[model samples]
Target: MLVYVLAIDIGASSGRHILGTVENGHLALEEIYRFPNGAAMQNGMLCWDREALEGHILAGMKKCKELGKIPASVAVDTWGVDTVLVDHQGTPIFPMAAYRDRRTEQVTDKIDQRRLYALTGIAHQPFNTVYQLMATPADVLERTHRCLFAPDYFHYFLSGVMANEYTIASTSALLCAGKNAWSKEVLCMAGIPEHLFPEKCNMPGHILGDLKKEIADKVGFNCQVILPASHDTGSAYMAVPARDENAVYLSSGTWSLLGIETDTPVTDEAARAYGFTNEGAYGGKVRLLRNIMGLWMLQCVRHELDDRYSFAQMAKMAAESCYPHTVDVGSNRFLAPASMTEEVKAALREENKPLPKGEHDLFRCITQSLAVCYAQAIRDLEKLTKKTFTSLNIVGGGSNNAVLNQWTAKATGLPVYAGPAEGTALGNCIAQLIALGEIPDLPTARQMIRKDFDIQEYLP
Candidate 1:
């Protein structure tokens, strides 16, 4: 008997509801619904439209029923760091701040960075929940009763349960370095009340509860609402089909998280200085990775082009174009630049490097520079882990860029296997299968994925 699961994977730009099933001892995915997602500028601040997302979620589930496929369970996985605050009655106190918002810029300076890192082992990012909470007004904090990360909030809405999942909590820079709980010292230093967060953090794959009656009726199904790593990158990493432990995993999408999984968190000074973060992964593993500004550069450039060119067109042009000039694509200046193309030009002019003559040239420059960044990050990972990785596994949407994949393989002198673009959704479904006892364990699931998906390999 085949068991079906629904995996709702949400990224920075879009979200999709993928129906998954284990057929003939292999995984199969069918995307049923997709919707655009983005931050909206409102009241002088950028915020997520929670109600809009919730409506889309319901619509997707209803479509599943229409197709006569009521899943045994459903799970949601979303980008990390951003969260929502609720009052005693479980009502949102304020709009959810987008992680890219500038409100938290000064909050980091107020806290002791070294001490905070010592306690949490999370690299300092202006948009982390710790700094976001610190940026909140005193009155707002006084009224807050609970804090739920983005995915947790959606789960709460579906199941009427309020709890934080460990994987996503680790991204907040509020959780302890090596523990599964929040860091009280870091909370106190950031002026955030411990009581505002969930009383206990639940591990990935913990069943929250059955879907609330109204939600179930609306969707025409009553299935378990499970947590699937909660953090999209965590889910993406889980889908990496590494035959051996000596491979670096890159969850490439709007942001690129390149690193390796470890049994222990790396909290030493060298790791910290290199900006490596130790995030929680499935089965209590730590994702010791560095966050790189990824395809957002291309996405921004596409936007600047007024959506005149498709990504495939850009990639094809990039493959044929020749541009020797390169700029550091991971610079913070590109974070929320008003015009990405302008920003690239500015960086090139500042460096006294020749600027790209055409759009294809610009695209080539971005891809080549990102490959350079990947090469450097791979070397850094080797130093931090004290083990040389023999291969690199690129997963998620950005992996489909054949040009970038070949460039990365050539630049790093390591074999690159890029595929399983739906990694986040697949991993989310895998967690649901594990919870349902359909899959034995993560290692076995990875083996199944290796046989199930189409992975293209590029040799150095």
Candidate 2:
């Protein structure tokens, strides 16, 4: 009998439920369900619709029942830093703010960046969970009973067990990067109570429990609710089919997280200066990455156009244009802009640079600028880590853009391997397979991915 597993991978813009099983010495994946997701304004703030997402999760599981592929285990992995605050009775408080909300604009200013970096080794981002908690109203914190990262909250809802996963918790800047545990000093700095978090964090592949009786009955089956990295990037990193030890990883999607995994956190001043963050990887490792503004710009521009053009069309248009201008795609001005196209135009105008003449030119500028950003990040990463990366592995949904992959190769002067488009989902499944004893360890899983997936290469 085939042992099936479900990997629910959620990002800022979408989510998918993928069923995976090992068949004839290879992994096979079938997407059971997919759903659109995004933040919406709630009480004057951008917030996730928790109830709607919960409903979608249940609906996806029901799809599995219909297909007669009731998974032996199920796990969820989502974008990190945004968390849910629960009341004493395990009910989530209303209005779980998104990481993009402007409320954290001044929250980081209250703490010393260098000092905090020393404590956590995380980059100073205005939208980090530490800043978000600090910006939260004290009245709300008073009534809160526990703080669970988004994936943890969803896991709790499924298993009726409240717990924190290390990878997701590492994004909060409340965990000591070197120690891989909660930091009382950082929590005190944010004025967040210690009681809000769990004393011990569960690692990836940990089986929380069987799905709650109510959830099992609703979905028409019971399965183990396992933890799979919890943070989407953590899972994405695991799917990188690197040929050697020196390859840099780029988990390209809404955000371009470019970095290499290290056994110890890099917290020196040079690292802090270059804006590298040390998020947790599986097995107590650290992923020292830089979060760059990524396809979100193109995604916004496409949305504004009512999505008339598919991503492929946009890429083709971009490749046809020889736009000479490249804007600083990493600028905060591009973050949550009123109009992405207009914002790019304004940025060019401010720099006395030629503005993009039309849609093709604009699209080319975005892709070229992103390539430039990726190149700079690689340079900085090499400098910080003191190791020259021979290749770049670009994964996740964004890996499908051949134009961007080729340009990334040219910009960074490194061979770019882009494919296995459902990287996050693949990595999510890897954790489940490992826990189920179908795979022995991470290296073995990575080798399996390399053998089974089509990883396209773009040479510089």
Candidate 3:
């Protein structure tokens, strides 16, 4: 008998409900639903539309019922660092602020960066939950009851179980790097009450419960609500079918996360100086990674082009162009830029580099810059981990760009394995499969993925 599971993987810009099943010893994924997602300016601050997202979640579950495939378990994984504060009655206290919002800007400087890094092993990012909470108004914090990371909030909405999943909470810079628990020292520094977070941090693959009665009635069925590595990057990394221990995993999307898994967190001065973070991974492991401004520059550039070309067309033009100039793709100027195309031009102008002559030239410049950024990040990872990675696994939607894959392989001087574009969803389902007793363990699931998926290999 075949068992089915669902993974509702939500990213910064979009969300999808993917159905998963093992077919003849191979993992298969099918898209059940998809919806556009973005932060909109509300009351002079960028915020997520909670109503629309909740509605879509229900709609997707209803679609599953319409298709006659009721999953045995379901899970959700989303981007990290952004969460909502709920009152005692479980009502949202304020708008769900986007990580890109500038509210945390002033608060970040007040926090002791070195001490926080030593305690949590999270890099000093302005948008970290610690800074966000510090910037939040006193009245709002006073009324707050529980803080729910995006995925946890959605999980509670579906199951009426309010619990914090480990991986997503780790991204907040409030969780201890070495221990699988919240760091009270960090929380106190942010002026947030310790009780605002869940007392016990739950690991992924544990069952939250069946969907609430109303949801089950609306969707025509009930399924166990499970937790997958609730941070999308954590889930994405779980699906990497590494050939050996010496392979680096890159969860490439709007943001590019490049790093390796470790048994312990790296929190030394060198790691901190390199801007590396020690985030949580499945099975109590640590994901030591650097967050790069990834394909967002490309995405913004494409948007400025008024949707004139598909991603494939842009990649083809980029591969053919002879533009040799490159800029720092990880620079802060590119983050939330008013005009990405103009930002690229301005970055080049400041550096006294030649500017792109056309849209294709712009594409070439952006891709080249990103590849170089990836290469440098890999070098830094090697330095921090003291292990030389032989291969790089590129996953998520960004893996589909063949030109970028080739450039990455060339830039990193390592073999690149790219595919399983729905990596986050795949990892989310893998946890459910294990919980449902359909798959034995993560290693076995990875082996199945390697045999089943069309993983394209590019040589340097």
Candidate 4:
């Protein structure tokens, strides 16, 4: 028998409700609803329209009704950190701050970067929920019973339950690396209210509650609400369909999450110093990886230029351009810039290189530079893990840019397997499979993935 699940996966730019159905041991996904998401100014503060997002979630749940019968489970996963402050009534206390917002300024410097890394075993990302929460007003901090991540907040809405799942919580600085509870050391040092976060729970996949009677009647789904990996990357990591131990996974999209699977946490000094994070995996494994700024550079530039050209057109333009890579793109300045095209050129002019002649040249530069950065990160991973990776699985919307994938393979000298772009959703269904016992664990889920899906392999 097959079961259906709805995966609500959120990114910085957008959120989607994807329907996943598993039948006769094969899993498939369909995007049922999607909504635009981004940061906005609220009373002089950059805040996420979290209310609008929850509206999207409810709207999506309604969409599931159009398909007849409710799904067996509904799960959500989102980008790391940046949570909402909810009162005991489960209402948001304040506007959820955008992760990119400068609100963390008050807490950023106070944090001893090395000590923070040592304690949490998480890479130092500027937008971590802990730092952002620490920067919140003191008054709201006093009234909060439990802070919930974007996903958990929605789960609470749908299931009328409250709990923090492992993967998303790992992104917060509060979780102790090897322990399940909030770390007093981190809370004390960061001056965070311990009660701000929900009590940590065991793992993600389980029944949260029956769909509320109103939602159940409206959606016609009386099924249990299961928490599939509540972190999209954790869900996406579930789709790394590598057959051998020598393979590495790249959950490539807005962020290029490149890493190898491990049975245990890689908590060495080098791993910490290099900014590698030990995120949770589906089957009691650690996803030892680094988050590289991915196609966001290109997307921001395209948005800045008023979305004048399709990304596919840009990829074609990149492939047509003739250039040996010209500038150092790994600098932090390239991460977030007002104008990516201008930044690329300015970085080139600084190195005394010829300015890229036109759009094709500019496109080629970012694609190639991104490929080089991927190669560099892969090299760093190889150095840290002392394991040679044989293939790279490129998933998500970024996989459509074939030019970059070819360059990535060329630069890294590894075969690239691209597609199954709906990685997060696929991973979400796999987790349901785990919960239902159709799949024993992550590796077996990945084996089933290899059996069911078609992946395009690019050779160097």
lDDT of 4 by residue, 6-42 (tens): 8888888888988887677677778889989888889
Instruction: Mark the regions of model 2 whose C-alpha exceeds 4 Å error after superposition.
Output: none
| Higher-scoring candidate on lDDT, 1 or 4 | 1
Q: In model 4, what is the error at residue 150, expressed in angstroms?
A: 1.2
Could you tell me how far off, in angstroms, the CA of residue 139 lies in candidate 4 after the best superposition?
1.5
TM-score (C-alpha) between model 3 and the true structure:
0.99
lDDT of 3: 0.92
Compute the lDDT of residue 115 as modeled in candidate 3.
Answer: 86
170-231, model 1: which lDDT tens digit per residue?
Answer: 99999997578888888888788878875768998899989999999899989999999999
What tens digits encode model 3's per-residue C-alpha lDDT throughout 402-438?
9999999999999999978999999999999998888
Estimate, for each residue in 1-460, the C-alpha lDDT of model 2 and write its tens digit. 8899999998899999999989877988999899999999988999998988999999999999999998999999999999999999999875779998999987779998898998899998888999999999898888888999999999999999999999999998999985657999988888998888757788999999999999999999999999999999999999999999999999999999999999999999999999899999998899999999999999999999999999999999999999989999878888899899999999999999998999999999999999999999999999887899999999998999999999999999999999789999999999999999988899998988999999999999
lDDT of 4: 0.79
Q: TM-score of every model?
A: 0.99, 0.99, 0.99, 0.95
Worst 10 residues of 1 by lDDT: 191-200
- True-structure lDDT of candidate 2: 0.93
Once model 3 is optimally superposed onto the true structure by TM-score, how far is the C-alpha of residue 243 displaced, in angstroms?
0.3
Candidate 1 — which pairs collide? none
lDDT of 2 at 253: 95
Clashing pairs in model 3?
none
